[model samples]
Target: MKIGVVTFPGTLDDRDAARAVRLAGGEAVSLWHADTNLHKVDAVVLPGGFSYGDYLRCGAIAAQAPVMESIIKAAKGGLPVLGICNGFQVLVESHLLPGGLIRNEHQHFICRDQKLIVESNTTAWTNQFSLNEEITIPLKNGEGGYIATDETLKRLEGEGLITFRYKEVNPNGSMNDIAGLRNERGNVVGLMPHPEHAVEPGFGPDTKIAMRSGVDGLKFFTSVINSLVNA
Candidate 1:
């Protein structure tokens, strides 16, 4: 399968995301923010970074980019989309997923290896995870807090749309420790962690087995490949 990784100006992790895709056994296609085409890719990934320098609001301006126009339509039609960190901000800003990401309650940027639990593994991005499995991935963001109206939160909870939850601590004060979410169709997912950073052995997070050997995040990409193959 071919997975397109979108790159907006100031995007920092597009190459990492593409590498993850390649490591997951898929062809990585580079998609630019200025282009309205998706290049016939099978899936899309919005990588992390401060697009438009996070001016006005994180992802607010980049959400209006030409590529997002195509992405929005494709996502609604069941194209698999994964948004990480700043990309999560863009997904919320694009209204592809519910709720919004605000600044961390502590008012500072944070970077760490964070624990997350797989809440629902039925989504395209998370199908490789076992239910309730705990995994650690890199979490770094300034405006990573997730918020939604009470009604929306209730709806998401009731509908089983919550995909991942913070396992031990809420790193950015996301409501109910929601680290990630999926759309009702389970095709689109947005999260505030950098899964791409954890796809390699020596570069991944430290784990009990070995230093920087936790490659749990590789499943996020492989899951999509499996999903597409099984589809």
Candidate 2:
């Protein structure tokens, strides 16, 4: 399978996301923000970082990029799309996903190994995980809090669209401890954690067995490949 990793002007984790795709047994393709073409990728990932230096609002400018125009159309047609951190903000700004992310309640940037529970495993990006399974991934963001209207929140909960939830603690004051979400079609997912950072055992969050040994995030890539293969 070929997965496309998009790189915005200020994206910092595109390479990491590409590496994760490769490590998960898929070909990684590069997609640029200015390009309308997706290069025929099976799925697409919008990795973390401050796009346009978070001007106006995080991911606000990047949401209007040419690449997103193509991605939004494809995503509606069932192409899988995963957005992380600032990319999550873009997904919301582009209206690809519901709700919005805002500055942390503490008014400071945060970086840490975050624990998340798989709330829904039916999405293309989360099929490899078991429901309610806990995994650790790196999270870094200044504006990561998630908010939504009551009706939207009820709909998400009723439809099982909440893909991941914060475990142990709510790190960013996101409502209902939402850490990630999938669209109604299950082809689009957005989260504030950097799953790309946890794909490599030696470089990811530490585990009880060994230092920096967690590789739970690799499942996100493999799950998408599996979804494509089965499709």
Model 1 lDDT per residue over 1-231, tens place: 999999999999999999999999999999999999899999999999999899999999999999999999999999999999999899999999889999899999999999999999999999999999889999999999999999999999999999999987898899999999999999999999899999988787877767436698899999999999999
| Backbone steric clashes in candidate 2, count | 0
Please report the candidate that would top lDDT against the real structure: 1
For all candidates, the clash counts are 0, 0
What TM-score, computed on C-alpha atoms, does each candidate reach? Answer: 0.98, 0.97
Once all C-alphas are superposed, what RMSD does model 2 give against the true structure?
A: 1.3
- In angstroms, give how far residue 65 of model 2 lies from its true place: 0.4
Model 2 Cα lDDT, one tens digit per residue, 85-144:
988999999999999999998889999999999999999999999989888998899999
Every candidate's lDDT: 0.94, 0.93
Error in Å for residue 204 of model 1 = 1.0
Could you give the C-alpha RMSD of every candidate to the true structure, in order shown? 1.3, 1.3
